[model samples]
Target: MGNSKKVILLGNFGVGKTSLVRQYVFRKFSDDYMTTIGVRIDKKMVAVNGQEVSMIIWDVAGESTHQKIPNSYKLGAHGIIYVIDVLRPSTYLSIEKEISSLEDLLPNVPIVKVANKIDLLTEKERIEIVNNLPLNDYVLCSAKNGSNVEDAFNKLAESLI
Candidate 1:
């Protein structure tokens, strides 16, 4: 086993951070939307370039006017997975702000943009959003159906290596 990598899943409320983690970790899905009150951690083993890597994921509570991402939780992250809901344009716009805040706290770590709920968007909408975003690497994922979930995780791991 190689060194375990620390990663974080961050986004606004109801953007499906828990759902994404649940799908990736257990290959399961639920229709409910429950806000995460605090940080939740999960571990998974993945192989990158023939080397075994353990991913320690920290799914932080969604950002809110009353609650912000805890400063203590942002320390020592190897990378961050910033998730946005495709059906909510506001969530997309907030990505920059989230990245900016996170960068201020954990500067120099890699960040992977994820457009979640792809299953809810039309083809044209997806193209339009993807084309305009500045992300060099992004994924249209559906945690509900387990689509591209692993790919998103693998891309982050590969970038770390």
Candidate 2:
């Protein structure tokens, strides 16, 4: 492995942060909705572009724009996986504010805007929703179907290196 890097999954409530992490770390998914209390940590080893890397994933409890994000959770994070459920408009709203918060708290860390739960949307709908996001590039994924789950993690690992 090259190096261990701390990466976090952050987004609004019910956006599938735990699902994404579970699918990536364990290759499993459940339909249950168990809200994360503070933060759940998981680690996965991945080989990215011939470099092995350990991705330390911090799955923080989801919160809305009205709620305050914990800066303490952002410390030591090398990358951010800002996940969004594509079927919900409210999850994607306040994206700029969230990004701004992350940037302010954890500057210089690369972020992968992940559009999760694509399984709930048709291909056209997914494309349209992704195209309309405030991000320049993002990974469209489905934790339930295990779609692009590794890719999202790999993208983050690549950024860390």
Q: lDDT tens string, model 1, 32-66?
A: 87888788899998889998889999999887421
Cα error, residue 159 of model 2, in Å, equals 0.8
Tens-digit lDDT track of model 2 for 37-153? 988999988887887788888899998851366677778889999988888889988888878877887789999999889999887887788788777688888999998998888
Q: Output the worst ten-in-a-row residue range by lDDT, candidate 2.
A: 65-74
The whole-model C-alpha lDDT of candidate 2 against the native structure comes to 0.86
Error of 2 at 99 (Å): 0.9
TM-score of each: 0.88, 0.91
Instruction: Name the candidate that leads on lDDT.
Output: 2
Structure candidate 1, residue pairs in collision: none
